[model samples]
Target chain A: MSKQEQLQQLLGELKAALPELKEIIVASSDGLPVAQLGESEIATRLAAMAATAHGLGKRIATTTHLGNLVEIVIRGDQAYFIAYAIGDKGILGLTTPAGSNLGLVRLEAQEYARKLAGIL
Target chain B: MEPLKIVITGPVGAGKSTLIRTLSETEVVDTDAIATEAIGKPTTTVALDHGTLRLDGHLLHLFGTPGQERFDFMWEILAEGALGILLMVRADRPETLPVARNILDFIKSRAPVPYVVGVTHLDQPKVWQPEEVALFLGTPLEHTQGLDPRRPEEAVRPLVRLLELIGTNA
Candidate 1:
């Protein structure tokens, strides 16, 4: 299948697995939206922010010798914004309700991020 | 020495990163990533570029912001605590002036700091001069000047001008 189709399918699978997610965006490492589920209006800005967060996270990790960065999580009053690096080329971001099970979400999202790395 | 924070901002491909890299005394901390859009370059600054310089015995901390509007959130974040701003624009690409003006207005509204406009790419033929860019931007001609971002001597002129402005206002 085409790369775009593959990306959509991967996002679809992730969405199905985590219905609690309020937003999902798959963006290129350069801060461009590839595929997104939920709020289309915010996908572009959020995608850029995802790349920015990933870039900063990597720098912080290297500076502190924290090993490779796994994910970046921002806790808000009503929701959680979490971004995971998909190999070297892309990132997977998810917005979840504040009270959701973050531990389980991280496990599933990290696996999906690895799969996304393979596809992209 | 207390560092004087200076912010360099403009539209895409305006040489904001290059100017900071050129003026910095130490290695620059840049967050550049691959470009997915047609921005005339393969890479773009996603977050900010940070560098330091000791100009005339005064320590200067330089921060460069991403050009794309999608990253407008960063403009304010970097502009905060900044003592001056150097807004760069490409003389070759007149189309970006509107965006440049918007950015200037946005930052000025928030930071209200002294700012100077640096018109880059004047080395190229058929490009706007500093005076024209200043006219179009509605800024004082004295507050705008042309410079080559790749050269340290030329790139530092606008920053020096900004420092002068900040000092005069203070």
Candidate 2:
């Protein structure tokens, strides 16, 4: 299968795994939306937010003498958004209901990020 | 003894750099300088801000991540081996709560570390109470406190308390 196809499949897998997720988006580190799943409008906003978050993560990496940011998760009362940097140019953004299995979500997100990194 | 690694972070213009410079007597690494040198432009730090201090014979390494959401990658790396976190917020910037929440989320995901909220610009009129700031950030009550980042002696006390909290929690 093509890389794009594989990425789509992966997104499908994530949605299936975490049915409570509100949105998932793939975005460039520059804040551009590349691909997405879930509510269209929310995905667009999330893509933008993910890009901004990724940029901030890069700054944090450079300032601390640590290497780079792998992932960042934001939790609210009813929602959770997790962004993971995939390689240098891309990020995987996931939004799930609050109180979901964070460990599982993180694990899947990391796995997909790695897989997508190989493709992108 | 080895220096304790501490990360100070918050929204833009929140006085993170000023706080570290005032509280620590040692020379700061000035990551912004490095960033400028690297990018060859007068760019703000796209990464971390660094400094060092000595207190009671122990060295404390201080790092400050950029407050903007675009440079968040630096937070993960800076967080490693961190003894504690000092979350700085400006009294005038109510928007800092979202940024603070994001930082807290990042920190909680890694390890449970002690953190103190330093409310900067408290000397300014119309400052929010520490309790109110805590509520805004969704942090536990009593975890937030007002601070004058320009005052080194005053800033160091809260920092020391943060370190103590880390020690106790760890």
- Residue by residue across A72-114, what tens digits does model 1's lDDT show? 9999999999999888788999999999889999999999999
Tens-place lDDT per residue, model 2, B36-91, is 12222343444566778887677888888766565565677788888788888888
Give lDDT: candidate 2, residue B34.
Answer: 18
CA shift of B144, model 1, Å: 1.6
What TM-score goes with each of the models? 0.93, 0.55
lDDT of 2 at A91: 80
How displaced is residue A77 in candidate 1, in Å?
Answer: 4.7
Clashing pairs in 1: none
Candidate 2 Cα outliers beyond 4 Å, as residue runs: A1-120, B33-43
Best by the DockQ measure = 1
- Clash count for each candidate, listed in order shown: 0, 17
Measured against the native two-chain assembly using Cα atoms, what DockQ does each of the candidate structures obtain, in the order listed? 0.69, 0.06
**Candidate No. with top TM-score:** 1
